[model samples]
Target chain A: MIRRFIRLLLLAALVAAGFAFWMTRAVPLDEDALAGVEGDVENGQRVFTAAGCASCHAAPDTKGDDKLVLAGGQKFPSNFGTFIAPNISPDPTEGIGDWTAAEFASAVMQGVSPEGQHYYPAFPYGAYTKMKKQDLADLWAYMQTLPASDTASQPHDVGFPFNIRRALGGWKLLFMDDNWVLKNAPSEQVTRGRYLVEALAHCGECHTPRNMLGGMDTSRWLAGAPNPSGKGRIPGIAPGAFKWTEGEITYYLETGFTPDFDSVGGHMVAVVENMAELTEGDRQAIAAYLKSVPEQPSE
Target chain B: MKNIVTATVIAGVLAGSAALAQNDGSAQVKARQGQMRVIALNLGVLGGMAQGKIDYDAEAAQNAADSLAGVAMIHQPTLWIEGTSNADREGTKALPAIWEDNADFMTKWDAFVTAANDMQSAAGTGKDALGPAMGGLGDACKACHEKYQQSDD
Candidate 1:
């Protein structure tokens, strides 16, 4: 009876180990999706601006024209850990210059690096996963044109189990959804707005609250979260709570001026700078889309 | 009777001085805040015209611009005492960076002054002229706030 009991316990442990391995497997984008794709530098520039790549990837406090430099090393403190931005410049030694288009797409869209490791969600690949393949290609082309920085990427300061990159695969499996929060966008403008908000701009990365596992709680999309800095809340921009007209929202994005004449504040100052680079119509679309989001009070 | 009257006068003077000393930091903060509200009030009028929310009245536009320029020209250093930062007080959004980075703060102030002066010149010309002037003014306000002000929201 003792021997039989020990055999059953060993069998259960083996099954559990196998389940963990299967769940933690890296899933990259299909190579066929990237085949024959050509990148246009002009459109790439647009995609780059919309993604606000330089906002985080650039060196902190980079001003004016130097804002274009993708030297990285900006420290982003979060509940999980402090993520040090990687140097994504075209430097072969320190940046992604050696990465192929397929490798880049997999990293951006699937959160799987070329070496088959899962990246922490702090990089916000969950939102980028919704991005169009063409846009990703264009972004790659545009990135290649920018000047490269030789700055080495720093390791994140996450502790214990959070430091284990393999565990992030399970985290991604549970949370990395590419589905549109707004399933039925009413118009072409609204549709474009959805793409911008969901895919390109990643406004939800901050606005949407996360679960205990640090994945976005999609049920409360755009309902805002506690400012990770523990100082204040990142306010929700959902229609019910935000209450700004489409025109007012567009103007705010373009000029950072509210209806009350107060200027934009905090991290939004950089967001507005990026939004200003977009076309007037694009800003209008963002406003319209924001107006369409389902209402949820920012807790 | 004269000695009693002098004693009362001295007591009153001391009480007044004590009150002044106690409220100095907060008073300075409130005064600067009041000046900011004055700026906001004038900007609202100009902004309405620029956005076509309100009809462009040259007189109203000119008046608002002049008021904004006047506030911008204020050089009251006492209104930013060291202990009045948000870190040290309640219900204030003034960050300590204001004192630490005073040179940058002054530079931003200079920019706002320039923008306000430009608005004073351009406001009465036409609504078309008001928009560009407001842009420069808004940018200057934002530049300063981004650095030294804690976000209210």
Candidate 2:
């Protein structure tokens, strides 16, 4: 009986050791061609808007020009706990000023921090992982021009098991590949739309359903889920989630009306506010991408 | 003796407003809901122009904004006479919080009036000015919905 107990303890130890090893692995960006390119500040600003980085990182309830500060105090609530947005300001001590371009690219695309730690997916790096390297460089250049804020990033208020950043490695292992969410594209427009929706726009961060572990279920991508806000449904915009045609979807992005003539309501109202600002082609690309996504039966 | 009389009068007024429910808010529910739909229509026009989704037609925007202002001005005090929640009615997405906190609900309505008035003036100026004004008005509508309306989720 004592020998059996000892063997059980050893097995448990081995399992724990394996998980630790898996969780600490660093995944860096592998694009070799991006190394020598210089980033453009003008295009970087465009990337900033497309990525919607300010919405999460800016101070909560900030309006108008204040969004440019990027001091990072927005709080996002989740089943695990609350996540406070970290400072992405240009301040040397509190922000990313000291980060190398490669570090920024890796953090933004590969979800690896400067210290080689995994950033929380709340940063939406899963979608960013598919971002083009040039865009990343431009975004980095744009960040350089923003005013450096003195505000510090706050610690996340998560539960014990969820709080362990290392554990995120396992979640990353399951969901962190950099391939396009839609592998086969029918057209260049569809491909552009995919890049916008999957990478820069990061629409799936809210729209897609998650598995038990909180990694997005790409199979049901954009099929809609309960509002992360915990109030209403986030309405699936994926194929078959609603019966909207490409034109209707485009019209809605432009005018905020659905087929039933329901005006934009809920959290989507804010999203439309952003999409409305994008160029007409950008909005059309998003519409095209939404139409092309493989259909899933209503969840 | 004089002080006590004034205090009693004040308390009486407060109690009267608190007990102001004269109906179950049934007959007026559809009218009120229809008012909400019209408001959304006006908002769509202004919002489309403001977001640059549609070309800025100053006249069209002004018309939409004016319609919004007109709708916001019509206060059916009797229509809000308590008990008009989704629980009691079939079409509403309104929560009982609207009736329970009538004073707060009216405050939100007042905000809508103020925002609509601002948008009414701003819409005539063209896109750049109207955009922020429309955003302010959208927030006003959203604030009420967040507190008073039931979400579809």
Candidate 3:
């Protein structure tokens, strides 16, 4: 009888180990290796502005929303619960002060945080992952120049299953694509804009609706979704809502106007305001890239 | 008949003065209307700042809080005397709920005033009091926006 009991315990242990292996294996990453990439911090700052990193990460009490001190407290509410934006500031105690460039790159590109936990898609790292290696390096360098703030990172108020970080491994496996940029594009300008919009800006985090599993349904990219803040529907950029022309879209990015002579309303007002601060050429490129994308309504 | 005519003339003058007091185009009416507009615009600015989701400056934020409080105190009597129609005339974001759910709105507005007053008082003291003052003011602003202001974004 004792022998049989031992056998059962051993079998249970084996099963648990198998499950753990399966879960971690689903979201693979290079643990021992990181590719070297050189970048220019000055140029990266421009890219950061174009990407609108500060719009969500930095609290507004300081400077313009485009300013990037990254002491995050912005709350994004969804069916899963509120995901409070994390402090990306360089404070050793409160932010990513201790993180290495490789770790940071992995978080941006692979959705893997320093402690090896899989981050939820809410971070939009799936889109960020597509960024060029050198651009990622540049952003990392630029982040280093920020003042080290000791603002405590807030815990997300997510529900039970989602609160479990392990579950995110599976989610990433199914939806997170490491290759974010489409290479060898027809036009350099279009490709550059796509790199900024998809991989860096991660615009789809708010604009794209989610599947039942809470992953972005690529089929409906930028088609619009419910506002994460519980306000109202976030209108799509597709031809249906405003039917924005290329010139109009580019002009709106530069000056915040629609074809109907209406300025941006609601959350988009802030987004447009940030976009307006970008270089005119960069704004035009973003518009060009958006226009080039295949039109598909996110259902 | 002569005595009746004298009484009728006196009544007509009194009625005309009263009508002038409430005329839409009167200076007094326009001034009050302008004050309400200023208050609404101030509240809108505060809300816009909050929605921008940036870090708040202690001094600038306190000033805004103090201004709102002062306006609320000055406007309180005017609101009560002029009633809901005055609120409507000002294009105030003040929802019908402000009058319909009178008790709740009043309670919230009073809380806001008190918080704003505390913030102003705290500013005179030192930076030590700034944090609490800002917190109180932010809470008041959020409470009202949650119920009153229409969602913009």
The per-prediction tally of clashing pairs is: 0, 2, 14
Query: Native contacts recovered by candidate 3, as a share?
Result: 0.06
Model 2 chain A lowest lDDT segment of ten: A259-268
For B1-153, candidate 2 gives per-residue lDDT tens digits of: 999999999999988866663344556777788888888788777766755668999899889989989988897576776657777867777777787888888998898899999998899897898767866776676657655777663
| Model 2: residues with Cα > 4 Å off, grouped in runs | A1-23, A29-34, A255-262, B1-32, B41-67, B76-153
The candidate, 1 or 2, that scores higher on TM-score is 1
Number of the top-ranking candidate, with lDDT as the measure:
1
Shift in Å, residue A33, candidate 3: 5.5
lDDT string, candidate 3, A1-299, tens digits: 99999999999999998887686543434643345566578977866765667766786434453356788888778888988888888888788989877888778777888787787677877787777777777887888887766778889999888898877877777887765434445698888778767876677777778888888866777788877666456667654453677776876665443443233444454566567767777777877887766676434
- In candidate 3 chain A, where is summed lDDT lowest over 10 consecutive residues? A255-264
Write candidate 2's Cα lDDT for A83-130 as tens digits. 899889898899999988888888888788878788888889988888
Cand. 2 Cα-lDDT: 0.80
Inter-residue clash pairs, candidate 2: A232-B153, A233-B153
DockQ of 2: 0.20
DockQ list for all candidates: 0.61, 0.20, 0.06
| Per-candidate TM-score against the hidden true structure | 0.93, 0.76, 0.63
Candidate 1: residue pairs that collide:
none
Tell me the deviation in Å of residue B99 in model 2. Answer: 12
What value does the lDDT take at residue A39 in candidate 2? 94
For candidate 3, lDDT tens digit of each residue in B60-133?
Answer: 65666567667767655344333434345553334444556667767767876787687667654544565565
Provide the global lDDT of candidate 3 against the true structure: 0.66
